[model samples]
Target: MTTDYNQIANQYKKAKEQPWRTRTELYSMMNLIGDLTGKSVIDVACGEGWLTRELRKAGASEVVGVDISEEMIELARRQEAREPLGIEYRVEDARATESAQQFDISVSNWLLVYAHDREELGVMCRGLANRIKPGGRFVTLITNPALYTWQSHPPDYRKYGIEAQLPESAYEGAPVALTVHLEDQSIVIENYYMPIDAHESALRDAGFRDVAFHNMTLAPDPQVGDEGDYWDHWLKYPFFIMIDGIKA
Candidate 1:
């Protein structure tokens, strides 16, 4: 099922506040991104622009956030209006995204999994590759293909505020349902599962090289007490993963 992010924009934004998002997901992605001083960045599937604003604040010379949902873009714009970060927000589909200016780096939180099949995934990869300058970098978070069949049953990550279930007869491009549980409510997000090799091949076919998959690493946080014991399962088998490649 195609998720109407427009209808769940507010809930999804609130989901970003979940502890695991910052302590692990964002931390892992940012570590892979490294420095951004004076660089230009394009954030595809930017959603509410939380990461987009962070990119600008990280000293990016220019930042543009693109999302397929108008409601998501509107929320991002409203946040920009209040803070005046000089970021640009656009409503566009990742498969069709064509930035006016190629960027030094392109980042996405959860774009690739939207592709229902290899063909659509290739289109999304090519679009991202085109928006990045030659030699630039591409970083993204995606459903961990490694975990798709690593366990007989899908993981129950409620301790981290998210739940994902894989079908008993899972196959390539199978739909996986993920629910993000906030303090007060929960939001369901639909994503597709593709194997690790499939993702690497698509990136390479789209002009990327040195494609790498990074495991989730937890940053020490006083807020999340006893990080090691609390995040053991996640460190061993994360629900999502961070991947990066250099545009060739």
Candidate 2:
């Protein structure tokens, strides 16, 4: 199914007030990447430029955020104007970025999953690598596919005899509402699932080397659960996996 960029843009605009778990994961991953002072960075598929803004605050000299959604880019531009973060937000497909061999670092968070095939992923990595100097870093975050299948169970035809299992939570709890496409009176939504091996292999084939996988676990909070609950259950079995590699 085609993703409706307008719907995604609207969600991002509203998400500014919500506490997104993925954003916290991205922040932790950024810290692990070390200092960004004076660095030229590109945030690929940068929806609403939130992470791009954070990168600018981390001392990146020039931060460019690109997304396929024009409305999202507009929102990002407005936010940049209000905050004056010296960031450039553009509406550009990740598979065809404009810059050529210019950026010091290129980062994509939870964006590669949008690629439906390996060839598309190769094109995106090539595009990202083309914009970065040789020896530059390409950091990406993706959901673990193994975790995905494990969380989503097959439909029991014998019991319910349904044609398809209505898409439900593929994660820990009930599936959250992901605005996919909106028509005059209805919206189409779907669940997202990914495997870590698919992500690593794609990066490797895209000419990235020394790839490393970092399993990220969120810190336990009183609202979520007890500390030991997170450490024992969630931390031991993280839902998100981050992969980093250097462009060859």
Candidate 3:
């Protein structure tokens, strides 16, 4: 929760399109989201608003990008100013943000990973659910619970952006750090280890119905190229877990 992405924003943005993000995570999540034509979307923890812009290009009529980091918001705003997308960016905590259920869909990339405890998890889910129309969905791409808990080092972990060196080892709500290999450098950030059960409980308590998790796949994509088959071990354990929460 204390990770300073502002300090590494430029490096991260530059590496955001690396296979870990663009190829596997975003590629899978966007597939799950399908077409957004004519839909209004709210992107939580939108960071540089890259995905927000993509949503607009995908035909989202209106989009709002929210983040707790002012630096991230500033960068997002600057980009918007340079190339207008009509996307609104705001600095708001994911746990406390209030809206009038105006959005048709809510999506977050690495937002829930900041929840440090049950209370925070509950708050996040509630806030996400509250921002969307009834029956609307909250789709999140998160660090996979299975991979986070899996202790053994996979042979192809690095290929999938996982590091064998874990900063923390304990299970269930323990603070952990993940190392991501980028082109020029590596990045590590602290994220709480919330198990799948805990995530489900929090979502259910927050009034979400039919919480389903779609495991990340090694499905071929333009970004992945031909080496996808080499990382069978990576696909066996999901590096990212996609969760769909329907507001009840």
**Best TM-score goes to which candidate?**
1
* Model 1 per-residue lDDT at 100: 71
Instruction: Please name the candidate that would achieve the greatest lDDT relative to the true structure.
Output: 1
* Model 1 TM-score on a 0 to 1 scale: 0.96
State which candidate, 2 or 3, has the greater TM-score: 3
Evaluated against the true structure, the overall lDDT of model 2 is 0.65
Q: List the residue pairs that clash in candidate 1.
A: none
lDDT of 2 by residue, 131-156 (tens): 77778888777644544354334322
Question: Model 3 residue 173 lDDT?
Answer: 65
TM-score head-to-head 1 vs 3, winner: 1
Off by over 4 Å in 3: 148-156, 160-169, 219-225
Candidate 1 lDDT score relative to the true structure: 0.88
Model 1, 33-126: lDDT tens per residue?
9899999999999999989998898889999999989999999999999999999999887887466779999998899998888888899999
The CA root-mean-square deviation of candidate 1, after full C-alpha superposition on the true structure, stands at 1.4
Error of 2 at 201 (Å): 2.9
Candidate 2, RMSD to the unseen true structure: 6.9
Deviation (Å) of 195 in candidate 2 = 3.9
